[model samples]
Target: MDARKVEKITALLISAMIVCLSFSGEWDWQTVGIYAGSNMPERLLYPFFHTNMFHALLNSWCLLSIIFIYDIGIGRLLSAYMIAVTVPVDTLGYFTTMDSPTVGLSGLVFALFGSISFEVLRKRYYQLWMLFYLVAGFLFPGINAVLHLWCYVLGLIMALLNKPVKIMHHER
Candidate 1:
């Protein structure tokens, strides 16, 4: 199968996961934090929980959309970069705010914002898409808004420092 086909399937699967999660109907913020936290002394095969079905579904949808767009526009490398950068940043946020107990994909969304900034800068052209992304970033509200902005700035820097690759070569 082609890369595009693979990406489409991935997007669909992620979206489906989000939709299914939304209907699970289990919510617990503190338990989720303990499960997903980075400071796990014990080795558990699975260590993550959700505040509620809606929370999982919402995050899954956000993640799926970000992955879909990243695959479509940039390719898997940058998508991986975004995810790599996002996890640490988000984990830091969670640890720092352990008292608050936060759980969501806002961090990943912020990573997407970072990816977008990179795209806009590298292309040297700000089209409607960039504007839409900027607006979306500004309008979206969550504890990680600042984190998203910081990651975006960092991503832009990463993109700028990295040499450009031929996107057309991978085009189907």
Candidate 2:
């Protein structure tokens, strides 16, 4: 199978999974998202769910865009995705005492943004745009700006520690 084909399939499957999960429940993030009293499973699982269809679609779009734009292989993308999901759950989720629980894939989206920024697009303008977006994110109600920042920093560190390897297609 061609590597590009596999990458596209993987991204599509992931995006579909996220959207499907969002539809599986009528409960909002407040009901299932990670809160201070949330169990371990909730912490780990909350990133996969979203509050609504619009949120799900936006996240899915970002996820697909990042994967396609950066040409990230499944292994690398999965690694960063896991890190984005788990690190915050175990770290900040342990210490934060917010009234609301955290949910959605924005953290992973920002992580991918950070990874692409550091490894592939080092342009100052791109980074400035991300910075502006990050700042603007704080102004929106119900946004987890802290989680986004943490994931972005984590993504940057992951890029520094292990740079992304572009996948090459070979037909046999």
Candidate 3:
């Protein structure tokens, strides 16, 4: 599918998840990944729900921007997020903490940020000065800097494999 179509579908899906998560408190455990005994599917669910509207919006904006800017397909976006952020978090959280639940889409957003940042730097696109915004997460003290850093590194790996080559024409 095209990037626009993928973006629209993503927006709709995220909106629905946000509404469902907001109204259903009991379902929080279902959407958010907990440090419980092995439940493999929970890894894939981490990106769909958030702690609050602000958290959802933060992730949604990052998601949309990455999709639109790089024209990343839905499958690529979903696969990268699940593999880069969700799976590792789920596996590690289980062994590390057995009670606290990790809830938020920040990991996915960090991956996106990392992908774009890596592509920009690797290509030496200095005119893309907007990369300075990468530190935007610094404003939010609650962010998982460690998790984000790991996911970002994974995103860079993904970018290297995918190679952002579709947009052959750079803006002059």
Q: Write the residue-wise lDDT of candidate 2 on 24-72 in tens digits.
A: 8777665668765667677677878888889999999998887777778
After superposition on all CA atoms, what RMSD does each candidate show versus the true structure?
7.4, 6.4, 6.2
* Per-residue lDDT over 1-172 for candidate 3, one digit per residue giving the tens place of the 0 to 100 score: 8667867687567756765675555555654653445365666666666666776776667666666667566766676667544445545553343354566676776666556655554455532433434445444555555566567667767767777566577788
Better of 1 and 3 by lDDT: 3
| Model 1 lDDT tens row, 1-172 | 8877776676666557555654666645444432234343211111123455665666566666666665444364345334533345345554344344445544444555555554544554543554565557556553434444554556555556563766756656
Least well predicted 10-residue stretch by lDDT in candidate 1: 40-49
Q: Any idea how many clashes model 3 has?
A: 0
lDDT of 2 at 158: 74
* Candidate 2: segments with Cα more than 4 A from true spot: 28-31, 88-97, 163-172
Q: Could you tell me the lDDT of residue 15 within candidate 1?
A: 57
The residue-level lDDT of candidate 1 at 50 comes to 40
Candidate lDDT (C-alpha), each: 0.50, 0.77, 0.60
lDDT of 3 at 148: 61
Worst 10 residues of 2 by lDDT: 88-97
What is the alpha-carbon lDDT for the whole of candidate 2? 0.77
Candidate 1 stretches with Cα past 4 Å from truth are: 34-37, 40-99, 118-142, 163-172
